[model samples]
Target: MLLANLMAFMLFGFDKRRAVRGMARIRERTLLLWALAGGGGGAPGAFAARRLFRHKTRKRPFVRWLWLIAAAQALVLAGWAMI
Candidate 1:
């Protein structure tokens, strides 16, 4: 989980920096994959990344997908807790 969040954090920061430089961008799909891989519980790493970098917060589709991933992670956590 720690590694997943760290990966998301770095990737998001790198993407934001590239955007500022008008350089090539990381794909949205890749970013979301890291978020989904945020491992087992709580909010996806992208949430922290967004807060820290102000990245993608204004993109409606991306935000929606992030939330969806969070919901799925939360569900998994809940199921685990039930055991």
Candidate 2:
């Protein structure tokens, strides 16, 4: 989880830098996968990097996916707690 969050954070920041440089961008699915992995492991680090890096703020679909991942993680945690 810690490693995943670090990777995700770096990916987002790298993507943002690429965007600013008009270079090829990272795939949204790749970004989301890292975010999901990070969130699944109980760290919002990717999302935090999102705010810190100002990446994907204007992309509604990406934001929705992030929320979806968070909700899913919450549900999973809630279910685990009930076990």
Candidate 3:
């Protein structure tokens, strides 16, 4: 989880930099996949950076899906804990 978060954070930061330079952007699905694979903590930081950088803020799908993914992960964890 720690390693995944670090990777996700770097990916987000890198994506933000790329956006500023008008370079090819990272795919939203890639970011979501990282978050789903235990990088939820870093995912929020990515979204924050996107907002701060004025990148992808208008994309409703990314924001909505990430929120859903986080919520689903939380519910799954809670369910597991209750077992």
Candidate 4:
């Protein structure tokens, strides 16, 4: 899980930088893999990158919802870990 989150963090940061160059594809397969691998952190990380960099603002609603979902998933995982 930690490894997955790390990968997501790297990818999210990369995607943000790439977005500045007007590149914003989801890399669907990789995203799905990350999400499935317990890297729910990716969504929020992506959202934050977008917001902080002032990119993808048009997708704000979608990204905001995704971030919320990611947060919920992270909480669930944390709870699971505690148990």
RMSD of each: 1.6, 1.9, 2.5, 3.9
Task: Please give the lDDT score for candidate 3.
Answer: 0.71
Summarize candidate 1's per-residue lDDT along 26-57 as a digit string, tens digits.
99989988887745622456788789899998
The lDDT for every candidate, in the order shown, is 0.83, 0.83, 0.71, 0.58
Give one digit per residue, the lDDT tens place, for model 3 in 1-83. Answer: 66556666667778879888999988988877776676234555555556666666777988888778778777777887899
Stronger candidate by TM-score (1 vs 4): 1
| Model 4 lDDT tens row, 1-83 | 56665565566567667766887655745643453455444554444445565554676655565556677787877987999
Task: List candidate 1 segments past 4 Å from native.
Answer: 41-43
1-83: candidate 2 lDDT, tens digit per residue: 78888888898899999999999999999888887784354237778888899889899998998888878887887998899
Which residue segments of model 2 deviate by more than 4 Å?
Answer: none
TM-score for predicted model 4 compared with the true structure: 0.49
- Pairs of residues at least 3 apart in sequence or in different chains that clash in candidate 4: none
What stretches of model 3 exceed 4 Å from their correct place? 39-55
Model 3's number of clashes is 0
Compute each candidate's TM-score over C-alphas. 0.91, 0.87, 0.76, 0.49
Q: What TM-score does candidate 1 reach? A: 0.91
